[model samples]
Each structure stands twice: as C-alpha cells, then as structure tokens.
Target: MSDRKRGSHRRVSTSPWKYVVATWFAGVLAAVGLGAVSPAGAALRSSLGLSTGELAWATSSITAVSAVLGIPAGWWIRRLGAHRALSWGLFVMSVATVAGATAGSWGMLLGSRIAEGVGYLLVFVAGPVVLTRVTRGGIRSAALALWGTCVPMGLAITAAAGGVLASRWTWNRWLALTALGPLIMAGVLTAVLPRLPRAPVQHPYRAVGAWKGALRLGAAYGSLSLVGVAVVMVLPLFLTERREVTPTAAGTLVALVCLGSAVGGLAASWLLRRGLALSSLVPLGALMPVACLPAFSAEFPLAVSGGAATLVLLVDGLLISAVFAAVPAAVSRAEDVDVANGILNQLGSVGMLMGPPVFGVAIAAAGWGAVAAATFVFGGLGTVLLLPGARTSGTGTAHGVARSLDAQDRVDVGEESEPLRKALDVSRPNRNRI
Candidate 1:
C-alpha cells in the first residue's frame, strides 16, 4: 500500500511541466497544420465552382469531425500512454496535412482533413490528461492555460505566416512548415515526457448526472469560445466588409485576440496563486458579453474604438483563460481529479462542437452585434448556473469526508475508481468543519 501510494505520488508530479507544454504545443501544431493545409477553402471552392453545400461540408468537417474523435482518443490514451500514441498520431497527421497541400481535387483535400481529424482528437485528449496526471496546483493551472491558449495562438500565428508566405511563396510552403511543426513536436515530446509507468485501469467514465451544472459549464465555455470563433472567423470580414480596413490591418486586429488570450493565460496562472475560488471564474465568464458591447457602440475614431476593443478584449481573453483554468480546479474540488477532468473535457468538447453552429445561425438570422448579444446572454446564464447548489451538503469539501459519507450511503464506489474516490472525499464546504 505504501509503495502504491508512492507510485501514485510519482504519477502526479510537481515537475514535468515541460512535458505538459510540449504535448499541448503539439495539439496547437495539429490545429495549425490543419488550418494551414486548407485556409482558403471558400476561395478554392469558388475557383473550383463547387456548390454551397459542398463548401459548407468541407469547411465544417475540420472541427466537427475532430470533436467526434475525442471519446475513443481518451480511452486509447489510457491504454497506450501519451508518448507512443501522440508520436504516431502526429506523424500520421503530418502526412495527411502534406497530402492535403498536394491535393489536386477537393475530394482528396476533404479526405486529408478527415484523416487529420483523427490525429487531432488523439493529441488534444492525451495532452490535457497527461498534464493533470503530472502536475498539481499552480503548475497544473499554468500548464492547462498554456495548452488552452495554444490553439487560438497557434491558429493566429499559422494564419499570418501562411498569408505572408503566400504573397511570395506557394501555399504549400506554409503547409510544409505547419506539417513540420508536429513532426518536431513529436520528437520533442518523446524526449522530454517522463516515461508513464503502467498502471491498471481502475476508473471508468460515468454519465454526468447534473444537467443543470453541465449545461451551465457547457454554455459558459461554449459561449466564450463561440464568440472567439466568430471573432477569429469574421473579424477580418468585419474590418474589410464594413470598416474598409486593409486586409493586413484587419488580420492583425483579429490576431490580437489570440495575443490577448496568451496574456490572459499568464493572468490565470497568477490568479491560481492568489487563492481564488474556482467558482469566482463565473464573473469573469460574464465579462465576455460586456466586452462585446463596445464593439457595437464605437462612436470614437477607428484607432480609438479598435484600441478600446483590444483592451476590452484583453479582459475577455483573461476571462476565457481563467474559466478554462478554473473549471478543472472546480471539478477537483467537487469530485475526482481524473474523472472530473474527463467529464469536464468531454463537456468542453461538446460545447466547442456546438458553439460554431449557434453563432452561425445567429449571424444569419440577426447580425454580428446580435450574435455578440447572444453570447452575452449565454454567458450570464452560465454564471448563474455555477452558483453553489443551495441544499448541497455533499459538495466542495476535501476528499476524505465525502468518502466517509459515501461509504455510509453504501455506494460501494470501490477503491480502483479514482473519480469516485475523489468525489466521495471532497466534502461540501458548507458542512465541512476542520
């Protein structure tokens, strides 16, 4: 038992933050590689004279298909460990990306995107799981923020780099670079990642029972990421379409959100050290909607409005990063770290999958301003939902007290189930004394 405890402690290290960074950057590379290989699908479609439906399918498959791959990827990582799985996944992904860059037909490009989807799921799922298993507290929060910010940050960098290279070089040059990032990432990850000692699979995923809570978390994450998606996708259009800003300038403005997000990551890591409750993130989450208000009411000069938007956007970015940082801790406070992490990630995946569509429909029915308002409404509702349950005696305490009560209740959650163990142990703060 003592040996097992030592092994478990070893599994959950305070070091190995580098491995966390590498694995997450690998996820970022996957996102960048996919984007680089097929950045201008609409233009490519018009050049090919493809139908609207075909173009939509091609454009949507990148993330939608990737989202569906998360479940199996999670299970696979538990069995194979992160290194071997990520190495092979990244290799295959790189190959597919290069293939897409070379494709002469839309069908081939679509196939490559679909293949990349598989690789994306494998890498993204494994990276976070590895981070949680390997770190605790501030390091863990920092690691997660690093991983979370990388997607937007990578996309911004890749998109800009692709545009700059495309002015003089072919698109394939940028795609090649993007593809190369993952291959290099795989090697770096393998070298730096500590060997994950094999352990018996003890915990299994359970269905989330708290729909009220799940919906709140989902809506909050989804709304924020949705606005982010809309901004990333449509900001350039907004600048060029409505404001007559130069494409380069517009692109720069759009990319600033990602820069803000990266900065926000550092803020979140700092917040963790301040000993803030995870639920406090709800207010930050609420700020996302408020941030959008300025974009609508820009009565000042372009520079002024843009700068104002950017500053508000910094807070928006901070909120998004903070929430992502906080949710895992919230789950840790509420349940088992691994199990709650899995469920939270699964819900995040679901939210991410759902976000784009919600924004798309709102964009069609109303407009960008309306979509922003919708984002605000969703976020507000989410904040309200995260408020601690009023009658909740079984929530928000340390792991041991919940365990005792669960044992008394005869739930028989079993020793192997880490989530059950954790959930039972974390007692409600309301009733927990000493």
Candidate 2:
C-alpha cells in the first residue's frame, strides 16, 4: 500500500479503542447513578418518612419519564450527534444526582429522579451509536457484547458500596459523594471525546416503516427489563423478608446477583466469537430464567438458596446481554441504529417503570412465588415473541445470500454471451446493406 494509504489507515484505527473505552466508562457511570437508589431505598424511606409506594416511585419515576420521552430523545440524539448527547446526558445526570442528594421531601427526590431518567436516556441512546461508529467488523460485535456489561457492573458496584456506605454515613451524604462521579465523567467526555458528525436529515414518515422491526425487537428486549427490574429491586426485600437476612446482607447478596450479569455479558461475547446466532441465544436466555426461577424461589438452606439465586441471576445476565446483541442484528441500516436504540431504551423504560411496583404488588398479594410466576410468564412471552422475529431474520439472511448468488450467475452469463454476440454482429453486417 502507498504511504498515504497506510497513514490514513493508521489514523482511523488509532482512537477507536480509546473511544470505545471512554464511551463504555460513561455508560458505567450512568448505570451507577441509576442504581445508586436501589440499595439505599430503605435508608431513604426512613430518612424521608416515605411510604412503600413512595419508595418505589424514587426508582420508577426515572423510567416513567424515559418511557414517555424515549422516541423524541432518539430524534434529538440524531440531531445533536453522539459526543454532544453524551456530554449533555452526563451533565444532567450529575445535576439530578446532586438534586436527589439534597432533596428535602419525597416529592423532591422523585422529581429529581424523573430528570435523571431523561439524562440517562440521552447517554443510553448515544453510547451504543458511538460505539457502533467507532468499531468495525468482528471488533464491533465483541465491543457491543462487552458494552452490555456496563449496566450490571454499575448496579453491582453501587449497590455493594451503597449498602456498606449507607450503613456508616447518612444516605444523603452517600448520594452527595457519588454524585461527583458522573460530574467528573461528563466533564472529561466533553473535553476529550471527538465530536461525531450529524446524521443526515431523514423523512420521519419514511423512517417509520424501517423502524417497525427494530421496535418489535425492542419490545421483546423490554420484556426482559421487566424481569431484571423485578429481580434487582425486589431481591433485597425478598431476602430480608422471606430469607430472614439482615438488610446489609440482603444488599450484598443482591450485589452478587447483579455481578453475575457482568459475567453473563462476557459469556455472551465468547458465544458470539464462537459464531452463535443471536436468535438461538435469545431463547436460551428466556428459558434459562424459567428453569432457574423455581430453584431460586424455593425453600432451601441459606447457602443452597443463595447459590441457586446467584445461578438464576447469572443466567438472567447472560440473557440480558444476548438481548443487547440482538439490537444491532435487528436493524440492517446504519441510520436506523439510533432510532432503534431509542425505541429499545423507551420500551426498557416502560418495563423498568412497571416492573418493580408490579413485583411489589404481586409479592404483597400472594408471595415470592407470585413474583416467580410473573417472571416465568414474562419470560415465556418474550421467548415466543422473539422466536418469530429470529426466524424472520434468519430467512432474510438466506434470501439475501440467494439474491447475491443469482446476481452473480446473471453477471457470469452476460460475460459469456458478450463474445458470442460480438462474433454474430461481425458475420451479420450484410444486413446493413438491405
């Protein structure tokens, strides 16, 4: 290759890995900010004199805003470019986290969380889009799989730390301290990350049809969020109430379960490297939870039950990672990624909005078994919905291959016919004399 070409190639490859890491780091901070509330829910409740429902509102409010504003956020991200979107998102999250720290009333905290949700949506939408742009080929799949770990890792780190910290310090102080993380990350991203070019203006009407498949995948993916939110939000409470563990122990155990999800993400990456299809992975994800939930919810010895629960959550994490892997697989066009991610984020918000409260209600009405049953139902439905789409995806791939082959055959036939046609033309030139 020419020196100019080599230099250009080197320049393109230089910063992508850096960009991927920074973007993923920003995502982790956002996840930490989102999860900082879960383990501290009890502390916040007592400190602020909140009722059970009000406590749930602290977390669900974020999702509520996301669900409502998700689609619009996608359009906005497309307009703003990924770098700017992330910077703004991190800034908003920092502000909201501080607001939550200083909240004087339950209502104030809820409102702050609502705002934080909007910030989280911005980061969430832009993170993958930026990652997609920076990475290419096999690296993109692995990077995305690794990207799936951010949420669970953030949840685990914050929940584990929050439990220990909240035990020593006031919840407000804990919140205030953690608020610095996203603030710093936001500033760093604004200063260091290169800005992405704006996406071309697309007609909204034409884009809608293209988004339908992504929307379906997003909905199916969202259903798993319901399962995830239920597990993360309720597991601590379940352990405290049903398993007779201390609040701190319950929090620690919950953190362990969340950590399992990080491992699951890595495992999914390994699977992708081995050439497993996203469709096969999705059903495995759905069914593993169904099989494990019973063991997790059953009455066993503490050690045995804890181990079972961890296994269940580990599988759940793997499934969540697989769902993320499916996102890029579902959308064929590059431009559609942001919109599809937006739809996924929005539906995920809906699931997050509903999951915890619904689980709480179910647990109240029946018991942990009810929660288990609910998870099974959702998982099954998600599996059923996902299979048809997976089949369609597979069929589309086959048809695309067939079309390529048919086109190649036509080209080959045309080349062979060219010589024959030329010879015939030379022999039949007397026709011009007529």
Candidate 3:
C-alpha cells in the first residue's frame, strides 16, 4: 500500500485531537441553522408576512427532521462512512443556507430549513462515531465528552451573533454570510481530519435489535430534553416576563449560560480520568432539575433564579458529555457504535421536538411553578434510565472495554456515559464496555 493509504490504517490515524476539533466544529456549524431561525423570526415574519406559528415551524422544522429521520440517518452514516458523511453534510448545509438566503416566502424558507435539517442530522449523528474512531483511553473520554458541547456551543454562538447580524444585514443577508463558514470548515476538515480505519461493514440494517442499554440512554436523553429544551427555549421569555429584563439582555445571558454546557462536558471527562466509575456519577444527573427548581420558580429572587439557570445549563452539558463518552461501552461490538448513536439520536430528537410546546402548555395551565414540576418528573425518569449500565467493567478505562470491532481487539471508550443516557457506555458496562 502507498504511504498515505498505510498511514490511514494506523490505529491512531493522523492527529486525533485535530480530527476531534474538526468534527466538533462541523457539528457546531450544523447547529447554527437550528438556532438561526429563532433569532431571525421577527425579521423573517415582517419580511415574508408570516405568522407566529409559521415562524415557530421555521425554527423547529430542522428539529422535526431530526426526530423523524434520526435513526435512518445513522444507518446511512454507517454505510456512507462518518468522515465522508460529515463532508457531505457540510456541503449540503452550504447549499441549504443559500436557499434560505434567497427565499422570498415562508414556503421557500421552510424548504430550505428542512434541507438544512437533513444536513444537520447527518453531521450530528456521525460526529461521535468519528471522535471514537480517532482517540482512545482517557483522551477518548475527553474527546467524546467535548463533542457533546457542539449543539449548545453553536446555539450560544448563533444566539449572540444572530441578532447582531440580523439587525445589521437583515436576516437573509446574515444567512448569506454564515454560509461561508461551513464551506471553509469542510475544506479544512478534508485536509485536517483523519481517515477512519476500516472495519467489517454491517449488512443492510434491521431496526429491531437496538441495544437495550442504548434504548434506555436514548430514552433518558429524550426525558432530559423534555426539561432542558423547555428551559432553554423558554428562558428568555421567562426572564423578560418574570424579571422585566430586556430582550437583548436576556438573549445575551442565555447565550453565555449555554456555553457552560462545555464545562459540564469537560468535567465528565475529568471525573473519568480520575478513575471514577460511570455509574457512581448518577447523582450528577440532578444538575438540570435541581437548578430548574429555583430558576423556573417565581418564589426565588432574580439573582438566585439566574444562578440556578446557569447551573442547570452547565450540568446539562456535563450530562450530555457523559452520555457521548459512555456510548461505546453501552454496545457490545464496535460496529454497533453508529447504530447505538442512531437510537440515541432518534429518541433525543423526539425530546427536542416535544419539550417546548409541552412546557408552554404546562405553564399556561399551572403557571411558572409548573415548569419545576414537569422538569422534576422528566429529570427523575432520565436519571433512572442511566442506572443499569454504570455498575460494570465497561464503566472503567477504555482498554478495559471489550466491545471493539473484532471481539479480541480492545478499542478505547475510556468509560463515562451517564450524561448522555450513559451516552458517552452507550450500553451496559459488563456486556460491551468499549
């Protein structure tokens, strides 16, 4: 084999962290479109003569596609290869952004957002697979943990940048500018991202035999989304109404708080590097609802509430990282990684779609106090789902995980999946710990 081909086959292909950075960056770019619509809503509505409901759909349409196509997207990514899928996803996002920029009507914009959704899911679902392929041991824990922060990071960036851009250039022109980022990033990844090592190709997928561990983790994620997305989507309005904060200030506060999710992601990795078992971190799941209690309640002072909100967000990030890091340990075979991700993606997508509207209805019926109630139930369910996988050997160091591509070859998971449905085992500890 040629030197290039031979090097691509190395266990640690290229500079793994650079690949992690590239994959994670691509994920963040995909998430921009998810938040792009919400900030641009008023501008788009005025420009296109659309309704509030129409505007809501425009923002959610990307999430809607994820809920519907998430599993299949994973299956396709499995066949397509994670590295190439990311590249294709980026190119697709560029085209979709251009379509939105040129759109003159709600219909046109919605179509563009849907296309972006397709691109978005491809990038999101495929990312972890790539991260796991490139790194091992404790660093693998940290890398996957870091990957979980992409969505919050992207949204935070967009929330801060989107309003400014929309004000300066108008929404469509703003979109035109953001379009170049992915195009540039895609080229950067082609050069900087490592080629994935080869593995046995699984035959055409059968959706029935999802790993039970993944199912529980995915369900936990969905439950967490029920609370987390509600808090995020509703936070600005909550602040504006509850504390009389200005729209811009509330948006800024939220954007900054959202970035705290990264701290949580890194924290999960830190715990693992210190020789913490994945299951022992179960109480860490309390980060969201515990913080939400005060943040969502009127009984607390504004300072206290805001502090709680920040805590919830940071913990949410930590849990998400934990799940992504744990996913490999959740499945028994290395080849199953993408499929397990599909399961998590599918369920998590469901939660993202459901969180906002459901929270809205609950608050309407019971008042702000209801937000705490709903989050408590959802958060408890999420915590419970992560329990089964934490007590095993799989929850330890990466080399200890037995679920590599071929049973004899140990790949790195480096443990820690609780934040993510145990996402980061991704399955039960003893069964497939890698």
What digit string (tens of lDDT, one per residue) describes model 3 on residues 55-160?
8888888888888888788778878878788888888888999999999998999999899888888888888887776665666767777887888878888888
* lDDT (Cα, 0-100) at 343 in candidate 3: 79
- TM-scores for all candidates? 0.76, 0.82, 0.86
In TM-score terms, candidate 1 sits at 0.76
Which regions of candidate 3 deviate over 4 angstroms? 1-14, 197-199, 202-210, 392-403, 406-434
Runs with alpha carbons beyond 4 Å of true place in candidate 1 = 1-15, 37-56, 202-207, 210-219, 311-316, 326-357, 385-434
- What is candidate 3's local distance difference test score? 0.74
Scored against the true structure, residue 390 in model 1 reaches a CA lDDT of: 13
Ranking by TM-score: 3, 2, 1
In model 2, the Cα lDDT at residue 262 comes to 86
User: In model 3, what is the error at residue 158, expressed in angstroms?
Assistant: 0.6
Can you write out model 1's per-residue Cα lDDT over 267-368, one digit (the tens) per residue? 665665465554554466556666665554435566765664564445545555554454443432222332333333455556555666676677678876
Model 2 per-residue lDDT tens digits across residues 1-434: 36555444445445456766888899898988887886677888888999988987786676687788887888889888877899899899889989999998998999899889889989988888776655544445556777778888888788778777877888888888777888899888876665555555566645566776778767776777787767777777767877778976776777787787788788877776566765676656555455445444646776666666666666666666665555655665555567777888888778777777787888789877776677777766666666655565345542343234223223333543432222222222122221
State which candidate has the highest lDDT: 3
